[model samples]
Target: MKHPKVINLVQEPEVFYRIQNKYDRIISVLGGSMQVGQVVNSDIDLIDITRRGLPKSVVITVSLILGISMEKMSSLLHVSHRTIQRKGDDELLNVYSTEQILEIAEVISRGIEVLGTLENFTKWLHSDVRALNYSKPLDYLDTSFGTKLVKDILGRIEHGVYS
Candidate 1:
């Protein structure tokens, strides 16, 4: 079965709050309230979010939520550790890095659906898995191909397929 489009945490107050509990910085970026007269009639503008580039805070928030370190985040984005460290909290990541970060967030949203909680999903990400040649799921998060592989595995798990 195909997974649903990930909710726009920026637009959905409930979902945003839920995520905020784990990634505290999200509230600052997305704002504490849904904007006045904002309509939730359609899916989130993934292109726009990517084009605008994600703030460095988003990268840090996601890393913390996933229980991954800043070093791991740098490797995943193929950016240097020092460069990531040098960026200001509000600085925007480049388009490529922003897209990858969004992709990871989407995956985390899906994983939560299947695994029940951020804590469980994060644990799964860090643990070795038989399906991935005994490699931790996080080991493959550094590249597009690997991200796809990990997503596929999550999809399989969601469908109750033995990996």
Candidate 2:
């Protein structure tokens, strides 16, 4: 069997620490393995982490990963800013929000795989692309349909297409 790719968090301390904090917050609410700074073997690991429901801190982490603001994240999740705030750290997101978070995580993992770095992927997401009708890929992340469009573009880019 082929071994899964391992992302060594120790090598990327900043991103590692950010994810560590998020993991800590998640475990605080949902209770899970408390190990920190471990490798993300695959997208499956991420999906497993949120199998129940994600903590609100995940929104902050995703915001950091995508370089978007909390307000934009609220828009993407189709929730009000105050609603997000009211949920607090211990509250779990609804099923739809959890699914969206998982989908975004999958995209983030794939983007990193294709672009070779999180910074490169974030730049690609924020840049306007002709294939996407000259709109920044980040703009399409506000809804499920838009997320699918961004994922399709990422798939094309992965396959060496000029998307």
Candidate 3:
């Protein structure tokens, strides 16, 4: 019998799919007259947008997407609710606030993607999570570490390993 030819195989360091997430295209989280054609496709794009600042309407849109009140959104951004409400829709938010809002939108997008719908993800956000020591995921929204934790859990849930 002839010896079989063996082919050396190497795995790719990163998987490349021709397809990309549609979410990155619309970035609907930045709602209100945002042109979906201009997508946030890279870290540099994210940084540039952050430096440019987001409109005040982003806060309102994200709050609605999250089904939370502006008062709650205000507390998360560490700003007065009145200040947020007083700002015009076209007014740009401060860099720090813009960054925070962007981060939150990222998490929201991931959660919705993983959970299959915004309604389901919103419910999950408010529900107490066992891995989070019975604290609601919403409670973790105030801190960066906690937001990361939420993202990790969402990843786990996506992979079917979240117990």
Q: Rank the candidates by lDDT, best first.
A: 3, 1, 2
Residue-wise lDDT of candidate 3 within 93-141, one digit each (tens)?
8878877887887788777678876678889998989999988888778
- Flag the better candidate by lDDT, 1 or 3: 3
Query: What's the true lDDT of residue 43 in model 2?
Result: 55
Model 2 poorest 10 in a row by lDDT = 28-37
C-alpha lDDT values of all predictions: 0.67, 0.65, 0.70
For each candidate in turn, give its C-alpha RMSD to the true structure in angstroms. Answer: 7.0, 6.6, 12.0
Model 2, span 67-98: residue lDDT tens? 88888989888899889988877577876787
- Evaluated at residue 129, the lDDT of candidate 1 is 97
Could you give the candidate ranking by TM-score, starting with the highest?
3, 1, 2
Q: What is the lDDT of residue 103 in candidate 2?
A: 67
| Clash count list over all predictions | 0, 0, 0
Clashing pairs in 2: none
TM-score of each model, paired residue for residue: 0.75, 0.71, 0.80
Residue 136 in model 1: shift from native, Å? 0.8
